[model samples]
Target: MATINSSIVIISLPAIFKGIGLNPLEPGNVSYLLWILMGYMLVTAVFVVTFGRLGDIYGRVKIYNIGFIVFTAGSIALALDPYSAGAGAMWLIVWRVVQGVGGAMLFANSTAILTDAFPVNKRGFALGINQVAAIAGSFIGLIVGGLLAVVDWRAVFFVSVPIGIIGTIWSYKSLHEVGTSTKSSVDWPGNITFAVGLTAVLAGITYGIQPYGGMTMGWLNPWVLAAIIGGLALLVVFVMIELRVANPMFNMHLFKIRAFTSGIFAGLLAAIGRGGLQFMLIIWLQGIWLPLHGYSYEDTPLWAGIYLLPITIGFLIAGPLSGALSDRFGARAFATTGLLLNAATFLALLVIPVNFEYWEFALITGLSGIGSGLFSSPNRTAIMNSVPANQRGSASGMAGAALNAGSSLSIGVFFSLMIAGLSSSLPGAMTAGLSQNGVPANIAAQIGQTPPVGSLFAAFLGYNPIESLLGPTGVLGSLSAQNSATLTGQTFFPELLSGPFHDGLVLVFVVAAAMSVIAAVMSITRGSRYVHVEEAVPEKGASVPQPSTRSV
Candidate 1:
C-alpha cells in the first residue's frame, strides 16, 4: 500500500517539474530533475535489502508502521516546499528520498507478512492479489497525476499526504507483529558496498542520456565510464564480502534454486521490455502525434493518459486471471507464453509509423499490457514460492530489486537508442523543412543545431517552442508575415519532426522485441513449479533443506 502511494507521486513528476517552471533540457536542473523522477526508486533499491534484513531482526510490523509515518511526513514536506523551479526541485528531491526510505520498508516486508499470515496452499492466491494491486496502482498513478497536475501541481503531492496519514493510522492500529525476529549487529560492509555500487551504476545510466559536447549522448563521457566501471567493481567486492561474512546482507545461496533464478531473470527482462514503452508512447502521442493531428500540445498530457487506458484495462483483465490459472497450470508455461505475446506486440509496433491511427496504437499497447500482466503475477509468485517461509522477505526484496533496477536500466538503453536515431536524422530534416517553409537559412541552421531530445521534451511539456527559439526582440521581424505565421502554426514543428521521430521509434521497438523474445525463452526453461518446503516433498522421498535458524 505504501509503495503504491509513492508511485502516485512519481507519475506526477513531469507535471510537477513543469508547474515549477524548470526547463527539463537545462543541465543545471537535470540532476534535480532526475532526482525527482528517479529518486524514489533509487532510494528504494538502496534500502530494500537493508530494511528487509532489519525486519528479520526487528518485527516486520514495527518497521512497516514506522514506514507509514515516514512516508506521510515526506508527502507533507513535498507539498509544503517553498522554493520555485530549480530550488523547488531540490526541496522535492530531499523529501522524495525520505519517501523512498519509507517505501522500502513497506515493500520489503509486504510479501513476507502475507506469507507468514497465509498457509502454504493459499499463498499463491494472496500474493497474486497483491501483485495485481501493485500493477494497477502504477496505471492509476498516471491518471491521478494527470488530473491533479491539471488542477494544481501541489495537489499531486498533497493527495498523498492524506492517504499516507490514513494508511499510517490503519497500519498502527490493525497490523500485528507476526514474523520471526532476531537481534544481530548490522552488516555495515555489505550495506555500504551495495549502496555505493548500485548508486554509481544507476547514476551512470541516467547521465548516459544527456548530450555531451559534439556527441549525441554521453556513453563515452569519462565520468560516466568511471561511474559504471567503478560501480561494477564495487559490486564484485560486495559479493566477495558476502561470501565471507557470517551474516551477509544478501543470501547468495538463493540463486541455486532453479525456480528462484529463472523467476528473477524473467522479472528483470520483462521490466526492461515494458518500462520505457510507457514513456515513449506518451511522448509519441502528446509531444508529436497529437499536436500534428490538431490537438493543442497543452491538452496532450491528459489525453495521452486517456488514450492509453486500454493498455491498463488489458492488464486489469489479464493479471489476476493468469495468476489464478498459473497456480493450477504452473508458472513456466504462462510466463513463457506471456513473453512471446509481449514480443509479438513490440514487433507489431515496429512496423507502424509514429503518427499511427488510434486503433493501431490502442491494439498494440493493449496486447503488450496483457503480456506484462500475464508475466508479472506468475513470475512474482514463482519467486516468492521458491523460498522457505522465513526467507520470504529477503527473497521478495531481491526480486523487486531486479525489477526496479532493470526498469531504470531500460530507460537508459531505450532513451539512448532514440536519441541516437534522432541525432542522425533530426538536424538535417529540421534544416530542410524550415528552409522550405521560408525560414532564413542562418536561423534554420541555428535551430537545427538545437538538441532534438530537448525539443522532444519541450513537446512533452506542452511548451510553445517559438518563445524559446525567438527572443522577445523578435527574430521573426526579418521574415514575411506569411512565413512567420506558417512557422508558428500548430502543425509546423510536429509535421516536420514526424518522419525522423518515426525512424527512432521503429528502432526502439525492434530492440524491445528482440529482448522480449529472449525473456520468453528464459522463462520457458524454468520448467514446473514446486511447493514451498514445509508443505510437500518429492514422491521419491528426497528431503528439502530447511533454512537453518539464525540471528539477523
Candidate 2:
C-alpha cells in the first residue's frame, strides 16, 4: 500500500487536475503540480529515519499499526476534497503529506519486522519478496491509477481505504514486537536539523526543474540556491550533533559496518538511475512515441502504462529468484551482476531511436527491471542482516532514506539535463514547424521562445500541446481552419518534438548508464555476506539484553 500510493499519483495527475479545475501549465500553478508530485516523497524521505528510531525506542508493531489508520484517514480526506482550483490543489497536497507521514512509519519499520520474524538462513528469501512487492508496487500503481482515473479521479484515493483498513486490523492483531526495544529520549536537535535540511534541499530541487526568469529551469533563482546551500550546511551540523547525542535519531556508527555502508551507497546510486529512467521512458511514450503511432493525447497515459508491462513482468520474475539465490551464493555476485546488466541495457537504450519498435523497447526495459530487482532484494537483505537485532529499525530506515532521497534527487538532476538538451535545438525546430503549418512567423517565433518546461508538462499530462500553447494567445483563432486542425492533430507536436526529445534522451541515458556502472562497482566491493549475532538474555525478571557486534 505504501509503495503503491507513492506511485499512483504520477499517472493520475491529469485526471486529478481536470477534476479539481486547475491548469498545471500556468506559471502560478506549476508549483502546485510539482508539490503534488514531490511533496509526498519529500515528507517520507525526511521523516522515515525519525520514525524508524521511534520504532526502535518504542515498538515497531505499535508504530506500524498506527500508520495504517493514519494512512486510511488521509486517503479518506483526499477522496473528499471539497474545493476547486488552487484551493482543491492545496487540500490534496496537505492530505498527501499526511498520507506520507503514515507511509514513512510503515516504510521505516516493515523491513525490520520481517528481519525479526525470519531466521538468518531464510532472511534473503523473505526480504526479497517484501522488497519486490515494494518496488513492483510502483509499476503496478501506474496501471491502477490509469484505469481508476478513467472512471473517476476520486477512485484513485478511494481504492486505498479498504486495503488500509484491512492491513491495519491484520497488523494490529497478528504482528508482535519480536525485536528488542531501547528506552531513550527523542533526539530533538538531530531530528529537527535532519528534517528541515532534507526538506529544504528536496524542495529546492523540485522547484529547480520549473522555469524561472528567462531560463528553462530555476537553478539560478536566489531562493533555490539558498535552500540547497543552506540545507547542506545544516546537514553537516546534523552529522556533528549525531556524533555527540546521547541517543541519536540515526546512528552514524552504523557506517562502520562494511556490508551496511556499501549496500546503502550502491542502493542509492541504483535508485537514482532507476527513477530517472522511469520518468524519461514515460515522457518518451506519452509525448512522442504513442502520439506518433496514432494514440490521442488524452489516451496516451493509459496506453503508456499498458505498454510498460514487460518491465514489471521482469521485476516480478527476477526479484524473488535473485533473493533466494543470494541466500546460498551471497549478495556480491547477484547484486553486482544485476547492476552490470542494468548498465548494458542503458547503453542499449541509447542506441535505439526515438521511433524504435515496441518489442525492442520492451526487451531493453524488461532487462533493466530484471537488473534492478536482482540488486534491490539482496542488497536490502545484506544491509538488514549486517545490523544488530536491536538496531534493525534504524538500519531499515537508513536504507529507505537512501532509496527515497535518490529518487527525489534523480528528478532534479535528470530533468535539468533533458531540459538543457531541449533548450538548444527545440526552439528552432518548433519555430520552423509552426511557420510551415501556416502560423504567422512572428507568433511562431514568440511561441518557440517560451520555456520548454510548459511543453514537457503538457505532453506529460496528456494535453493537446498546440491547442494549449496557442489557444491563450489567440493565435489558434486567427489561423485558417485547416491550419488550426493540423496544428492540433495528434501527429504535429509529436513529430516536431521527436528530434529534440531524442537529443535529450541520449544524454539522460548515458548518464544513467554511468551511474549504473558505478553502482555495480560499489556492489562488488560489499565483500562476503555477514550477519551480526545478538547476545542471549535471562528469562522472567532479568534486564534487557544488550546486542553485541560480531559480523561474519
Return the clash pairs for model 1, or none.
none
lDDT of 1 by residue, 1-552 (tens): 444444455455567877778776665766676677778877887788778777777777887778888888988998898998778888888898898898888878777787778765566667777777776676667677667877888988788787888988888889997766666767899999998999899889888887788776788999999999999999999999988998888778878777888888888877777776766776677677778778875566666777878878888878888888777777887788888999899888777876788899889889887888888888888887777665677787787678667767866888788887788788898888778877778877887887776766655555556546755436777777887787787887777777777788788888888888888888887767755555444567687755532211
User: TM-score of the candidate numbered 1?
Assistant: 0.93
Clashing residue pairs found in predicted model 2: none
**CA displacement after TM-score superposition, residue 240 of candidate 2 (Å):** 0.5
**Lowest lDDT 10-residue stretch of candidate 2:** 543-552
* Runs off by more than 4 Å, candidate 1: 1-14, 464-466, 472-474, 535-552
| TM-score (C-alpha, index-matched) for candidate 2 | 0.97
Each model's C-alpha lDDT? Answer: 0.76, 0.89
